[model samples]
Target: MSEVAMKPEIRVLETADADTFWKLRLRGLKEDPEAFGASLADSVDATHEEICKRLACTDDSFALGAFNPEPCGMLGFYRRQGERVRHKGSIWGVYVAPEARGTGLARRLMVEAIERAKKMPGLEEVLLTVSTTQGPAMKLYESLGFKEYGHEVKALKQGDLYIDEKAMMLRLHD
Candidate 1:
């Protein structure tokens, strides 16, 4: 196996990271709409305050950022906040800049996110949705022990094109 250079420094993002995180996230949504649900056009008007407010949430929900000096990629875990559903969390918004794709930054961020999720109180499984268009991401999740539970046809529609999404989950413990 070939070695990956550019040691990735991954950390859980706080409110202070909203600006950089927003920029990177907007780029991801704009560049690859099929991979994400949020569209740049819809979220562009959000004030910095709104952005910071969302990031300031220091609860079970968290956004993890990977920086190889600069912001390279991000992954997030959104905990289900119901009395009965709190045992599960959903992972979303996995993004790595095109320039950073081959460097294993995405994998590093994902592994760290999973590690954090396992440590989260009451969290037993982590779920994620990936469109069929995201083959690499799907394969990466599969390699990391996530199993597909179902597929949703026409899960997303952009203009006239419909996309199918696969729902996958990883059990943190037996």
Candidate 2:
């Protein structure tokens, strides 16, 4: 079977997968700096132990990995912690490698994340931000039922480039 024809194994990444997750995350940050809120430099000093802590799955937070026998795509979801905001969650660090872009891997990861979010006890809505430069990603989120609620001008400044970001949200229930 052709590699592209095979379904990727998507699962919640755990502590042991931290190293793999970190490498892919760095690539994502570096390869598409404007698409993410964090830069490669901000993450380079993060230790393996810190990544393991982040990957430790909890009822309200976890990271998903799409593996074609190795991590290729990643997305993070975490519910708000404070009492007033606990009903909301945010999706972060969404990335799919160049090789995986057209294979529907990103959509699969998103569907899985939304499904998981729906199961959380107090999760009423999920939110994420996308740079205006990411039109394809914005379209994918829209197709998945996310609505743009706001726009931030110059949300991120990378060198001389200023990225505007759209904030989008998906409500799980009425």
Candidate 3:
């Protein structure tokens, strides 16, 4: 049997990584406009404070970065609060640089995010939404054990076009 190539190192983002994280995030948004709700054009005029606020949220949230001597991708998970919703967490803002796309960085990021979700205090499952056009992303998530639990019709409107989103979930057993 052939051997699988090992992936580059991945680690949780620390306070010092805020700028690097933001740069990679904006790059992802710019390159894949249809994959996310946020646009680089909109974020271009955003202040450093706005970007800091986003990168600084780590209380019940996790932001991971994959590196090959430099940051190449990022993925984040935010645990739901409120007594009723605390059992769930949402995976959001997943992205990999174009140069890193075919190297399995996305899968590595998802693996780290899922492991983090499984360790959350009361989390029963993790949820994420993907645009219907992102078949590759859908396949990656599904391969990692996420099920297509539901879909939101015309959930996003982009310049006269309506896009549907598929809601996916991965359950962690008690």
Error of model 2, residue 50, in angstroms: 1.4
lDDT of 2 by residue, 25-118 (tens): 9998999999999999999889887888777699889999999887899999988999999999999999999987888889999999999999
lDDT of each: 0.87, 0.93, 0.83
Candidate 3 structure quality by residue, lDDT tens digits, 20-83: 7888888888878788877788777767776666655565887888887678988888888899
Which regions of candidate 2 fall more than 4 Å away from where they truly are?
1-5
TM-score of each: 0.93, 0.96, 0.89
Candidate 1: residue pairs that collide: none
Best by TM-score: 2
lDDT of 2: 0.93
Give the CA lDDT, 0 to 100, for residue 122 in model 2.
Answer: 77
Which is the winner by TM-score between candidate 1 and candidate 3? 1
Better of 1 and 2 by TM-score: 2
Instruction: Give one digit per residue, the lDDT tens place, for model 1 in 8-58.
Output: 678888888899998998899889999987778888788999887655546
lDDT of 2 at 34: 94
Off by over 4 Å in 1: 1-5
lDDT of 1: 0.87
- Which candidate number would show the highest lDDT if scored against the true structure? 2
